[model samples]
Structures are given as structure tokens and as C-alpha cells.
Target: MKISANQTKNSLFQKIEQVRHRQGKVRDSHITLAHGSGGKAMRDLIDDIFVSNFDNPILSQLEDQASLNLASLMQQGDRLALTTDSYVVDPLFFPSSDIGELAINGTVNDLAVSGAKPLYLTCSVILEEGLPVETLRRVAASMKKAALKAGIKIVTGDTKVVHRGAADKLFINTAGVGVIPKEVNISAHNIQPGDLVIINGELGNHGAAILIARGELALETNIESDCQPLHDLVETILKVCPDIHAMRDATRGGLATVLNEFALSSQVGIRINEESIPVREEVKGVCEILGLDPLYLANEGKLVVVVGQENAENVLSAMKSHPSGKNACIIGEVIPSPPGIVLLKTAFNAERIVDMLVGEQLPRIC
Candidate 1:
């Protein structure tokens, strides 16, 4: 077979055009201002770090807004649930988790605690100029893995680069949308006397993990952040006890903050025994040494659940059967008197108020 020179030139031109249009690797080692200028550099960054990892049909179109199927969402439930959060913890990478996984799990927990089946998520990241491109790739890979494990998709997102001195290493913001069934209604307003206070597992792991990551205290211990998605655990609870009065993830403000919110919202008092609350010995040692209260520490995967007295045992049993709620326990019960107050009964038979955090205990603990 004989090929003409003109045909060879035409083939070469077509191949070059294809390479220019297709998704490819980012060539720069460190991020620059030009990467966020809506030009070729930005496209390369998104294609290499984000779109390639968060590959999905909706995001593949490269549109400004995600095009969703209304009928598809309706099939899951009658109502839509939405939540948004930002992650700016110092030291973007921590033990067992990073800012990327934290952002996905945090938003998912928000939706799950509301009795919604998490469906989709939108991710946006602010990158400081001069950040290593590998760091961005690592974060994007983690987000992809976390979203995949949670059975959710990243449908749309944006990226911006700031001056190196103006911002930290990297920050991520995420918004999630889910579907809430008609039968499920979980809220703080539904709390009442005779309800049981339940927590999924040990508290303060996240705060302790972050503190250790920051190297503020000279300590040594094997502890990891309890960062995880909780939709499955919530679903397990819904199957057994659909009439949950109130439920919330013990996140930034931890167990005390959540209990106080329930009490104030429902105008009822919550009494929990100190012995019933779970805390790792390492965490306790850290708190005790630092003269800090573990109850107010942050947690990424723990939740405070309040259910009717009749359904308390059933919910507890169901939660214990799940992976996230293995240490589930009823720490307290709602009392009729002293509305808007949370009473913590110490192990020595003494009691005190458990109030919301007044000021920053551990900064940037997200």
C-alpha cells in the first residue's frame, strides 16, 4: 500500500487537534494564578486533578450548572434535603483523613442526620498559589474515593487560586443534596420529655487527632480521626425506629453542644450520666493533661440521637448492629423540669450544667 504526503499531513493535523481538546495531565509542578483564570491552565488543572477523578455523566459535560433529572430525585423521596460546609482545618492532611475526605463526610453527615438519603455533591476548592500540584491531586483522589464509598457523585464544582500569602495551603467547600422520605422526620423541635439521649460512639477523637496533628502539645499516642460517612447508619436506625425525635452529628462542638441544642429547641431538660458517655483512654488522658473537657471536643463521625422512650432499646440495638454505632449507648433521658438546660450527672453522683461552647476551645478543629 502506498500513502500520499498530503494524507500524512492531514492525519498529523487531526491527531494534534485531538490532543489539544482531550483531557490531559497538568504540566506545572506548582499551582499559579493563571490556573484559575478560566484559561487553558485552569482546564488542564480541572481535567487532570478534578474531572478525571470525579468522573461522572453530569460533570463530564463541563457545564456551569449540573443538569439533574427531577423525576429521578422524586423517585427516592418526596422532599429534597440540602446542606453546605467549608473545611479549613490547619494542616490539611491529618491521620486517617484529609480535608478532602472530611469535606465529603461532613456534608453527608449533615444530610443523613436529617433522615435524608444522600444523593449528589458539588465540590469547590480554593488553592493557594505555589501549592504543589501533587497535593491537589491527592486531595481530589481522596474526595473521589469518599464520594464513591458513600454512593454519591460529584456533579459540579469550581476552583480558584489565591495568592500564596493570602490563603492557607488548601481549602475545600462542598454542598450536598439528598432525598427525605415522607415517613421520616427528625428534628430538634420534636424532642420531648421521656426521650433517650444516645450517641453512636466515642467522642473527641477528631479534636484530639487534629491537636496532635498540629504539634501544639508534646505527646505521643496512636489515635486517628473518626472521619466517615453516616448515611448507612442513619438508614439502619430509620428501619427500626422511624419516629426519631432529634438526631445530630457531634461535630465541631461535640456532644455537649448537640444536647444543649436539643434541650433549648424542645424546651426540655436532658440528663446524662457521665459513666454512660464513651471516650477513649488516650483522648481522656489528653483532655485531663490539658485541663480540657472532653464533652465539648469535636468529632467527625459521632452523632447524638434522641428517640422516644418506647423505641429507645430498639434504636440502640439497631445502631449497635451497624459499623459506625458499635459503641452506641444511652447516656441520658429527657426530664420534664428545667427547660433549656442540660444536666450531666458525674460518675460520683454529682451533677452540673452542659452548655453550648462559649468561645473557641480548639481553633480550626473542623
Candidate 2:
């Protein structure tokens, strides 16, 4: 049977109408104070955007709080892992990702590094009055997509509208919950001498991408934010090395900060060779021109893991097999002397202490 073009068009329109009927569309083109006034406008916006995109069994119930079964979670681990982060990236949308995905990945990584299987998340967003509704739609869709990819659910959320100029267009806060397996016990205090320091991927991609996105330096590059979920990668590593000592997602303070933290917490010295660290040329150029250290720049999808010597090879090989950990390498090793310090061995064969920075070079990069 041959279908007419008119029939196809009518079918498409019918589908669109069905969606609109199920999830009412926001009548306003832009957000207003009324949308956050706890009235009809608020209901419409939530039903049309967030609820529609983040549709799930729990969220669809539209309860004030999402309830989870403790028995189901207990099957995965004995302890719960919870992490919260706020994303105020200067630009809500950037080269490869937006604040929505950043919020999801940041919280997910925080839990993943602790050897947990992420379960649920709560997203709270504040939108400035006069902001375009389309922007919010895109963000909501991104969050839903990211949550699906990470195999987690955004069970509940809140929204608010602030006066124009009082807010930076949008700010999102997220709280995540996960379950740590009974056999896994990862912490910075587990670090020991002869342990290896390994990173999952190239450092500073996110910082460089945001810097280029801002167009502050009048420079152009192919850098894109390395924003992604790392739970899968963590699972891969654990499959091969269950006794992993410590793990941390290198975020705002970069790898240097994470290394310093591990060193200080474990009271052991960490020495990283400059040559072993992987950094893209674009990031190196940006850092050199601005007199900034790439080690101190932020990374959204990078991990720093310290493993004992016997399991280092297995962990490195396991990580390399995973996409997120393709660039995994041992940048340093733990030492007995010079406790509570991190030293970087430069390309010129000189050693210098790597200290924690009082501030981040790229603020609001998320």
C-alpha cells in the first residue's frame, strides 16, 4: 500500500498533538516570576519541560520526595555514597557540554571514585527571569540524556526564578546517591609507599575548552570539555583490581590538587615525572601563554588513582581497555621519605614541590 504525503503529515501532527496532550507545553516563550510563583505557570513549566524530559516511574509519581527500597540498594553495597555539587559555569552552554550534563557528571564522578554504583539524583535549578524557555528545554533534555547514559534516575527536582541581573542566567545544584560495594573500601588514607599514581585521560581539557568558549584570550582550538560519567570506568578498574587504594576525580583543583590531597592525607610523598603526564598541545599552549600550570587547571572527566605496585599493571591495562581510560598512565609513584608532600620531576631532570593552589585558575568552568 502506498501512503500519500498528506497522510504522513497528518500522522506526524497527530503524534505531536498526543505529546502535547500528555505533557502540556509551556505557554510562555520566556521564563517569568509567575513560573516560580507556585501557581499554574509553575505546574505547566514543570510538566512541560522537566517532568516530560526526566520522565521515570518515580518522578512521574510527582511526589515531594522519591522513595527507594533499602533492600534493593543493600544488594549492591553495605554503605551509601552521597555527593552534592553546584554548577555555575559562566556560559550555561559550552563547546561540548552544558551545565546540565556537568552537574550530572560531576556528582556521578564524585560517587564513582568512591567505588559506588550511582543510583539516584536530585536536581535543583534557579533560572533568571526573562531567560528563554528554549534554553531551559535544552538543559533539561541534556540532563535527562546524561542521566539515562549513566544508568541513574533524576527522581525529584526543584525550580526557581530570580529577578533578572540577580542571577547569572542559571545555576544548578545536584545531590547524588550511590551504593558502595561491600568488598570495596577506597580512601586517600589507603595510600602507601611504592603505590602508582594514574590518570584516566588527558588533563585540563575541560578548563581549556571553557577558556576557549569564553573567547577571553582571542585564541582558537579544537578543545572540547571532557564531561562524562566515570562509573563504568570505575567498574572496569575494580573488576581487575579490587584492592585499589585511593581514587579521586580531578576536578576544580586539577591533578596537582588531588595529588597533594592524597599526599597530605596519607602522609606520604608522591613524585610525578613531567614526561609521563599526558597533556594536549592546545592546553600546554594556553597554560604557557597565561603563565598558568596545566596541572592546576580543572578537569571534569579525569581520574587520579593510586594503586599498589603489584596491581598497577593490571589496573593500567584494564583502564586502557575502557574508552574513558584510554590515556591512562602512571604519572608518579608513592615514596617513603618527604612525607606529606608532592614533587614533580620536570622535563629538564629537576624536581620541585607541587603545592595546592589557594584558588583555581579558571573559575566557574565547573
Q: Could you list the CA RMSD of all candidates, in the order they appear?
A: 6.2, 5.0
TM-score of 1: 0.94
Off by over 4 Å in 2: 1-24
Error of 1 at 158 (Å): 0.5
Instruction: State TM-scores per candidate.
Output: 0.94, 0.94
lDDT of each: 0.92, 0.92
Which pairs of residues clash in candidate 1, taking residues 3 or more apart in a chain or in different chains?
none
Task: Kindly list the per-residue Cα lDDT of model 1 for residues 112-202, writing each as its tens digit.
Answer: 9999999999999999999999888889889999999999999999999999898998989999999999899999999889988999999
Model 2 residue 287 distance off true place after TM-score fit, in angstroms: 0.8
Model 2 / residue 217 / CA error / Å: 2.0
Error in Å for residue 355 of model 2: 0.5
lDDT value, candidate 2, whole model: 0.92
